[model samples]
Target: MKAGYVIRDQERPHFITITVVDWIDIFTRKNYREIISNCFRFCIKNKGMILYGYVIMSNHIHLIVQSRDGKLSDLIRDFKKFTANQILAALHNEPESRREWILERFAKATETHTRNKNFQVWQYGNHAEEIFSLKFMWNKLNYIHLNPVRSGIVEKAIHYIDSSARNYADEKGVLDITLAENPVTDTRKNSEFWKYNSYED
Candidate 1:
């Protein structure tokens, strides 16, 4: 599908969530999980977006970020595209020498899908929802941090390893995460007025 229907503004605060098609848990393997973490770094180092908080669910991901230098939509698109190809390649040539079993699991899942060659690591399209207010931003942040808790992965937010909950709570993580109140929209209450509106044609 074209981005026309799902397109969103990049340089704006947004509450974004993306899911794998059919809820496939492609990131259950640690190696694949690392790939996702790298995506976060790629965005930040490039000065595209600031990731406020996030959680990597079995098959889906929930995130809160804002585009500061570039479009958040383009950042997400690039991340997904780069990761999709990378994951697929790893599953093919390298096959995760460290996690061969996990590779096999992926191989088996793609057994029935026509789109996958050896496996389909990630499904495209992020389910993005722009956070338009302080209350809404806080709510979305809490929701993302609680994703693991809601899924029974951890009782406390800080314990979830593959999430940004720790960073928000002042705990150290593998990546440098800047946690602060993100400026919502350029126009306050009019925030919703421009959310998801692509400034770019």
Candidate 2:
């Protein structure tokens, strides 16, 4: 299979989205989400990944990330590969009621691509876009936090524990994130911050 798209620059933080094949709600489970969170922590510690912001949704994840070692592409590629393998292992070894169906779906997804030997957990292409301006950065940042809210999963962005919104909201969260050098204008106070369509392709 062809390699995923490459980033033009490693110095700039990029907004990336990683989605499950067929839009599977794999992260609905606590353990599955934990796997992702644990991987992020590991990457930050060992892989020179600097996660500025992130959010884990039922079927996808959004991240504002960069690499200190100028290996953003390498870090993302490995992160996906590692998470897919670990999640696949969990599917087989863990007690999931939808085990058979999930495995079959992943296997089916892989059959369409030569790159995957057995199963394909994450769909190819992160849909990465470099954050070029402070306005754009804040836009993506707000979009990440507001994802759960837009999905009707939460009443407020700060209420979503799976996202870095809590950190921006001055609350402690599960994963640690590097704050942006530019002070984040109060998103809550500014309704215009979230008015833009964040999911545009």
lDDT for each residue of candidate 1 in 131-161, tens digit (9 for 90 to 100): 6677787677767777777688776767788
Task: Show the lowest summed lDDT stretch of 10 residues, model 1.
Answer: 189-198
> Which candidate has the top score in TM-score?
2
Evaluate candidate 2 by giving its C-alpha RMSD to the native, one decimal. Answer: 4.9
- Model 2 lDDT per residue over 1-201, tens place: 223345789887899999999999999999999999999999999999999899999999999999999888889999999999899999989999999999999999978669998899998888888888877887788889888888999877777889898776667988998977544455445443334322223
Clashing pairs in 1: 10-71, 10-72
In candidate 1, residue 147 scores what lDDT?
A: 75
RMSD of 1: 9.3
After TM-score superposition, what is the CA distance of residue 111 in candidate 2 from its true location, in Å? 1.3
